[model samples]
Target: MPPLDSVLAGFADAFTLFNLLFVVAGVAMGQLVGAIPGIGPVMAMAIAIPFTFTLDTLPAVSFLVGIMKGGLFGGAIPAVLINTPGTPDAAATTFDGHPLAAKGKPLKATKMALYSSVTGDAFSDMVLILASAPIAVIALKLGPVEVCALMIFAFAVIAGLVGDSLIKGLIAALLGLLLATVQLDPEQATPRFDFGYFQLYDGVNLVAVAVGMLAVAEIVRRMAEHDGRPQPAAVPQSEEPGARGVSWREYWGCRWTMLRGALIGTGLGALPGLGSTAAAFMSYASAKRGDPGGVPFGEGNLRGIAATESANSAVMGANLIPLLGIGIPGSVSAALLISAFVIHGIQPGPLMFRTQPELVYGIFGAMLMANLCNLIVGQLSLRAWSAAVKAPASFIFPAALIFCIAGVYLSSGGLFGVSIMLIAAAVSLTLTAVGIPVIVLLITFFLGRRFETSLSQALTILDGDPRALTAHPVALILLVGALATGVWMARRR
Candidate 1:
């Protein structure tokens, strides 16, 4: 554990006026973007990275974390009001949220989602605070061989958990690995797949790829789906006589569901690459199964909203566990954070805590502060978001497209980077249309370089002897676990 003084200093750093202002700005921006259908927190973070290049580490990171937390709740706004999920994680929210909205209780549904989101986010933030250091300690003891094995295990788990077809997930992951091979070899200066392009020497730009696939591609997909017809105005309707905010008794009734969802989110978030969308769906399913006789789910049940929102929101915090603990980003959002950390000259993982305890704790404090800000700013801006959602998609998507292009250009600094982004966007759109899971591709891409580096180091240390893996019990165990999981998934399939 960090010493008491270090923790206090971290909090003091995080509470500075500059950091606080960025936090609020980030949350407000996140809320606005998330309420607009087809834009998400990941896209917002990727786009915002260029703007943060000139800022200090604490303010920049706090701003991004604020966006992440605020977007979690903001996604529910459109899900409840327009039957359109602003983010993929909010899809489960639409099941009950839109129904309740149809019943003239949009405010009630939105509030339930907001309260549940804040509760879950706070719970996960506390868990992250208490657990990250201990996990980092364990990680610090692991050798390169163990880390390689751990990456393999993570790959198996991600492939098995993400898509309906394990084969498709593996294919997507392998494609990511292939893309990761485009730059110079780690051990040698020779390029592999640069194809005579000097820009490929650094491999694909992470920010460009992320913005292209996650934001720009989604925009293209939505534009393709859009007809020339205007969208109906999303006017707020009057609530029924009893359809005000959630009653305290009703809130208390679903407490267990929220707890379970938070736990699920935390567990999954700590694991690499199994994202919040899966957690939300799993929590919703579990809630449905556990309370088969309760108020019918998908029929305006508040517990359904509570389960989905809590789990997804909790993931926003808990997804940092692997990133902070082991230097491995567990999701796209965490990957963006890793980029931010790197740009700020702070390496993540166990050594980060030892060398930068104040900064680490400052980030923790910032996360906690963001949660409070999410709750406060979420409420105050509810009416504004509700009104903004009424704007035409045509206006919104064009602006989003311009932002995507400008963000990619600013971050990468050339037409070559913009070209790569456009190509990635096209590929992403194609993959999505073909039913391939783009998330699997993105997560694997994020992890691919780390996996290769660790594996290469492990092999060099072992002198090309495969049996050397047995010398490390942790590595052996993880490989065995990966095998067992593979077998189980195959049988299940």
Candidate 2:
């Protein structure tokens, strides 16, 4: 258990009026932005990230974290009605959610989605609170070799989780890795791809890369569709007429699905490599397989919504576990969270537990409060935007792109940012079309340095001593565990 006094102190401080307001504004804005086609919390935060440069750490974190929670819920809106996913994580929701809409019960689907998502998110946050410390302690004992191996393990996991094809995932990973080389070389500080342009010295802006790949490419794809007739179909009830309310009977019945999904999500989130996509898929699979009531998964079942939403929301809390516990990010959202910590001059490695307990616990408290705020605000305002997607994509997408471009400028202050955006978008489009997954590349891109540094350090240690592995008990243990786990997983597959 965490120190009670410290936890209480941090929780109290985080609950102040200002932080509360930040939470509210962030969730609301996050939802609004998420409603726009092709824009998600990751890209939304990428654009907003530059603006937060001037704000204090708490407000900035509060604002960003709110979007993350709200974004999950926001995706449900479009998925339920228009069949478009606001965020990548919501892709699964559309499977059963849109089908539910076609069946003339959009309101019921939305309600079930909100309820299940909140439950899943809340459950995962609880898990995060309970699991982070033990993981952190384990992370502390990890040495260079273990850390490097962990990154490799993460790459494999993401590759397996994303897309239908492993080959595609590997391609995307390679693409991302290639792009990661655009800036200066880590060891020499010498620019490798500058080509005499000062803008290339900083390499590529992550914001530009994320926004371009996620939003711009998506926008282009939408425009290429048949006459842009505006994706359609959901029940009028989904719009939430005053008469509609969640049926008590349905709520009670589907509650078990929520519980199971949340539990699954929490467990996956604690692991370093498995993320939301995995959680959502696993939750839905488990829920379907464990179904005792003989509910059909694809035919607008409340149970389906429960499983998907619960796992999706739970993903946010679970993602943070690895980030806070070990310096590894299980998902893109956690990857961005790392940037937030960097901006605050806080490192997230093993020592972070000792050096920055307050921030760590404060983040936990914030996550807890954010999920509560999401449920409250989501339920309260669910009726307001339940109808058709009101805004045109032309307007929403342009504004999103503009914000992204401006954010890139503010963050990097050069045309290289814009170039990176176009390049990443094109690359992302190509990879997706060809069925390559980007996640494998994201892991390698992010953890490449750690792998390199660790490998070099271990080599140096080995040059002077042959018994280095024996000397470092923690490293030896980690190696054995990694090998065992890998073989077992491979065999199972």
Candidate 3:
């Protein structure tokens, strides 16, 4: 907590005028960038990073966090108006989000997105503040076998979420995991799929691949499908308060789903390495698996928006746990935030608690303010932004592709990144054409390492007893779930 004294001293400078300006500027830039497809927080942060060199640590970090908040919400913009995702994490948002807009409820969808996102984010932050230690304690007990099975469960759940077919989702997920494996073999130092390229020695960068497959690929596909059709102009619209007349009744109507999504996001977010994208996949899967009301998830279901938004939003807060408690960045953005700290000569970890309490708390306080800021700004502009739907996909898409190319290239200063983007986009397009679901692929990609690692650990701990999984409660539960899902699918078939 002692480090916090200096942090508090640092906080005292928030009123110094310059820091306040940076925060506003960062948020504005983030929103603008976020509205463009294929550019999210990562790209926003990269562009903003150069500017940080001109400022002190507190304002610099504050500015970055503010951009992050803006980027998170910006994804909803194009997704609702154009049906293209501004961020990879926002891909799921396109499902129900864009559909609702097409149905003349763009304002409603935007409002729901804001409320659900802020709700999930706020709750997750609270969990990080008050419940992270307890959750981490439980998470530490998980071993290799449990983790592997957990990955399998994640795979099953995600597969179940994508439309009506499990095969499609599983295939998509497996491909994603395979792509994820292209770079590094964690246990054995040998690369399995680098194809003799030194650029791949570090393995394929996830950001580049994600951008290529989701953002750039979408552009090419759009161009092929609709050649230069003029999109409609923006609609003049306004909302009651949220986005439409989003009533308290409506909010409470989906409260259970939102709360569940937040809980799942928080838990998954707390896991080291996995992040908001994974959180969205898993949360959607869980919603599908646990649904009692027979509502379709991918078809403009309000619950779907609530599910994805809440889970992904909560993931941000959950990512902070390992960062604050153990000095480990849970996601790339968190990793970037870590660098900002180190640049300022502030070391993170338990020692940080002793040294910079105010800075840490300042982050917490800023999170609250940032969410409020997002909500207020989101409500004000969500209606006007609906006009983007009027922009022809033909024009908007080329611009979107450019942004995607720029984002992937800027991730690292090399042309190889472009090559990877091409490869990923082609592969993703090929697979999707054959009916594979993206969420399925992403889950497999994320959990591939965790699966392999956990299985090996489980085996090691049990002296190679394959049946040892029966003794672990988590594993057993997963087994039961698999059995139930298999039986259900078979019956439906």
Top candidate on TM-score is 1
Error of 2 at 274 (Å): 3.5
Q: What TM-score goes with each of the models?
A: 0.94, 0.86, 0.62
Q: How much lDDT does candidate 1 score?
A: 0.86
Best by lDDT: 1
**Pairs that clash in candidate 1:** none
Query: Model 1 segments beyond 4 Å from truth?
Result: 235-242, 290-295
Candidates sorted by TM-score, descending order? 1, 2, 3
Candidate 2 lDDT (Cα, whole model)? 0.72
- How much lDDT does each candidate structure score? 0.86, 0.72, 0.67
For model 2, residues 1-493, the per-residue Cα lDDT tens digits are 3577777766776787888888888787777766655666776776677677777776778888998888888888888778877776677788788888776777777778888888898888888878888888888777666675566565556665556655555566666666667777777888887778877676566666665776677667766652645555445654445225567877888888888888888877766556676677777888778867654778776787788889888878888887778777877777776666665666776676677666667777777788888878877877665542556766666777787778767766677777777887888788777677655566556655556677677767767564777877756666566556545555655
Error of 2 at 211 (Å): 3.2
Off by over 4 Å in 2: 1-5, 91-104, 164-193, 197-203, 231-234, 238-243, 247-249, 272-275, 292-299, 464-493
- lDDT string for model 3 (161-220, tens) is 554576665566667667767766777788778878877866676555656655566667
What does candidate 1's lDDT look like per residue over 1-493, in tens digits? Answer: 7788998999999988888999999999888888887777887887787678788899999999988888888888999988888899999999999998887788888989999999999999999999999999999899889999987887888777777777887888898888888899988979889989988888898778887888889888888887867545663566566575888988998999999999999888888767889999999999999884665899889999999999998887888888888877778898788778866777777788888899999999999888888889977878898776666788888888888788778778877878888999999988877777777787778778888999899989899998887788899999999999878987898
- Which runs of model 3 end up more than 4 angstroms from their true locations? 1-124, 127-131, 183-188, 227-229, 234-366, 379-395, 486-493
